[model samples]
Target: MRTQVAIIGAGPSGLLLSQLLHKAGVDCVVFERRSPEYVLSRIRAGVLEQGTVDMLEQAGVSERMRKEGLPHDGFTMAVGDTRLRIDLNGLTSGKNVMVYGQTEVTKDLMDAHEARSAQVIYEAENVTPHDFETDHPRVTYEKDGVSHEITCDFICGCDGYHGVSRTSVPKAAITEFEKVYPFGWLGILSYVKPVDHELIYANHPNGFALASMRSETLSRYYIQVPAGTDVNKWSDDALWDELKIRLGAQAAANMETGPTIEKSIAPLRSFVSEPLRFGRMFLAGDAAHIVPPTGAKGLNLAASDIHYLSNGLIEFYGEKSSAGVDHYSQKALSRIWKAERFSWWMTSILHQFPDLGAFNARIQQSEMDYLASSHAAQVSLAENYVGLPF
Candidate 1:
């Protein structure tokens, strides 16, 4: 099979890129390893930056989100036993986050793609891109125990950090920068209702915890845990006790822990690969960079990367010129680094470090204190959190 673009990985980045390109009359094929059911059922980032919501609406994927997603006006910052509310409306003039999972966004795009009769090759195995420099790059995969190849002019690697696309480029010329945190977050989705209407970020002597909701009936929450912690180690009752100690002491969280739906220990790290493109293949989303979850910027960054790549592709393929194409890497890097810095700042301000100088921990606490006290500090966070406009 031949098309204008051969996209690897059917995650949100690849799917959205295909959707945007197809809407512009570009031909593209998306390949995925997971079944449709697993892709839709996975629980991931649930907060949408205001800008992301706008772009999805313009892309015609926000119909269900608008009807079902919960929007929050602000969040509570829990430090010790004091809870300070940062009204997002007061900070950003109505900019806020919509509670909709990244998985949901992927499903929405997938459904729309199918309705348009778009080709999404699922259960595709051993997918590899070869000869990217030419107009006939190929994606080889196996299906029904038989191997096959799809040829295209360009290849897009949206398979994320663990994928081979970034490695496909020469390492000597590539520069990588990453920040790995000592701790990880144990996230759980519960059938119980959220303790509060808006999300809560609780800081304690032990660690940090967060209270967020997926819907009115279902809620999501997280607590800091040791690195490489296993999700199965904690029982439902045990998780509830820690959550209460962190979140309940402040702001009267009437949390009721129901059946545990999903639990995972997610590591905290920040990674960025420079020059997100090489030859005829480009990388986006987790394939390029990763951020700590404290700021909830992962999906938003992925959305932005694909957003820019789509525009650049339109410019390159439409006019038969490499103007935008030539500068795609540089253009994408600017935004990528800005996001990296923001994610780093938020992560550092929240999590505690062991054996640190007492001054350092106090400094972080002071910063949080200032954010609660100073409108300027709160607005700065509000801008980044609502997400850089798409």
Candidate 2:
């Protein structure tokens, strides 16, 4: 097979890039190691930065999102019993976020691909990119006991953290920065109305808790737990009891409990692999970096990666220019680092760090107090929260 671009991973990042490039008249093919069902089954964060929502629109896949997704002008931040709403719209001059699940976004992109009969190969085994350092890059994979190869002008790795794309590069060529948090988030999805209309991020004396939702009736909630905690240990009722304690008296009073549809514990980490480009192959999304979900930046960061990458590829094909692709790494990393910083800061302030002693805990409280009282602090938070300009 021959194509202009061979994309690895049919996740939102790769799918969005292919959608944009296709719309721009650039041919590309996507390869996924797992079936579409498996991909959609993985539950993820739902909060969308304004920029992410716009990019979905740009890709012509935001119809369902705009119709069903919840839009919020602000969200509340709680320190113990005190709550302060960060007015995202007022602080950012009407900018706000959309509460849309990552799963739905992927489904929309996948539907678009299917409707267009785009080349998206699922359940391809051993997908690998080779000769990315040369002018001609190709990808190889096996399906149903048959091996196949696709030669393309470039290769894009949106395959994620454990994907072959990043591992394909020599270790010495990539510099990795990572910090594993001391705790993990025990999250549950329930079919009950949310405690609040908008999301609430709470920092309690015990731990951190987040009350978020996918829709008016679908509640998603999380509470911080020690690292390596087992999901099987906590029953639905037990988890809800913990949430009540951490979210405070008022929120707990309003909170509705129900049978959880899904439950999992995910560890928090901040990781970035520098220089996203390696010759003709480039890394996007989780393949390039990861942020703790504290600031709801994981999926948004991926969308931003697709933005820079698709633009660069479009420029390369349309104008016969390599400038965009040449500087893809630098441009993407600049924005990636900022998001990493914001996610790190949000995680630091909201999560209970085991090693950070009581003095640091007081300092965290002071910082939250300052953020609540100071307009400048709120503005800064709102700006970063709504997302910086793409």
Candidate 3:
């Protein structure tokens, strides 16, 4: 098979990239290691920055999201028992975020791909990109006990952190930076109404807790646990009891609890790979970087990467300009680092550190106190939460 672009992975990043490229009349193919059912079954962050929402609109997949996704102007944070609300829309001049699940976004993109009859090779095994440095780059994979090869002008490594694309790069050619947090988030999705209309991030003596939602009636919440915590150890009732303690009295009082539809634990990590481009292949989304979910920048960062990437591809194919394609890595990394900083800062301020003694704990408290008292501090928080300009 031959195409204009060979896209690795069928996650939101790859799917969205393919949709945008195809809309621009650029032919591309997506390869996935998992079945469609398995791909869609994975749960992920739902908060969408304004930029990501705009990209979805541009991709012509916003109808369902605009109809079903919840838009929020603000979110709450607790410092001890005091809840501080950050006016995201107000501080950012009406810019806000949408609470739409990533799964839904993937589904929409998948539907768009099918409507256009774009190619997505699912259940592809041993997918690899070869000759990326040369003029003619190609991807190889196996399907149904048969070998296949796809030659393309460019290759997009959207496969994610553990994916083959990033790993395909020689270690000496790339510099990697990473920080693994000592704790993990134990999250649950349930069919109960959220404790509050907007999401809440809580800082308590026990740990950090978050009250979020997928919709008006479908709630998603998380609490900090040990690094290797097991989901099976916490029953639905037990999880609720712990959440009530960390979220404070008022929220816990009005919060409804029910059997969890899904539960899992995700370890926190902040990672970034420099120079997103390697010859003819470019890395986007989790393939190039990762951020802790505290600030919900994962999907938004990916969207920004796609924005830069799709523009580069479009310029190459439409305008016959190599400028965007040439500078894609530098431009995308500039934005990626900012999001990474924000996510790291939020995580540090809100999460409990085992070795953080009296002085450090008081410092963290002071930061939260100032954030609530100072308009400037709140505005800064709101601006970053809504997303930095892309």
**What is the C-alpha lDDT profile of model 3 across 214-321, one tens digit per residue?**
999999999999898878999999999999999998988999999999999999999999889999999999999999999999999999999999999999999999
Model 2 worst lDDT window (10 residues): 76-85
- Ten contiguous residues with the weakest lDDT in model 1: 246-255
Q: Write the per-residue lDDT of candidate 2 for residues 37-59, one digit (tens) a residue.
A: 99999999899999999999999
Candidate 1 off by > 4 Å: 251-253
**TM-score of predicted model 2?**
0.99
Collision count for each candidate, in order: 0, 0, 0
Model 2 residue runs over 4 Å out of place are none
Residue 30 in candidate 1 has what lDDT? 91
- lDDT values for all models: 0.84, 0.94, 0.94
List residue ranges in candidate 3 displaced over 4 A: none
True-vs-predicted CA distance for residue 174, candidate 3, Å: 0.5
Better by TM-score, candidate 2 or 1:
2
What would you estimate as the lDDT of candidate 3? 0.94
Compared with the true structure, what per-residue lDDT tens digits does model 1 show for residues 72-156? 8787776654567878877899888899888879889989998999999998888888987666688898877999998888899
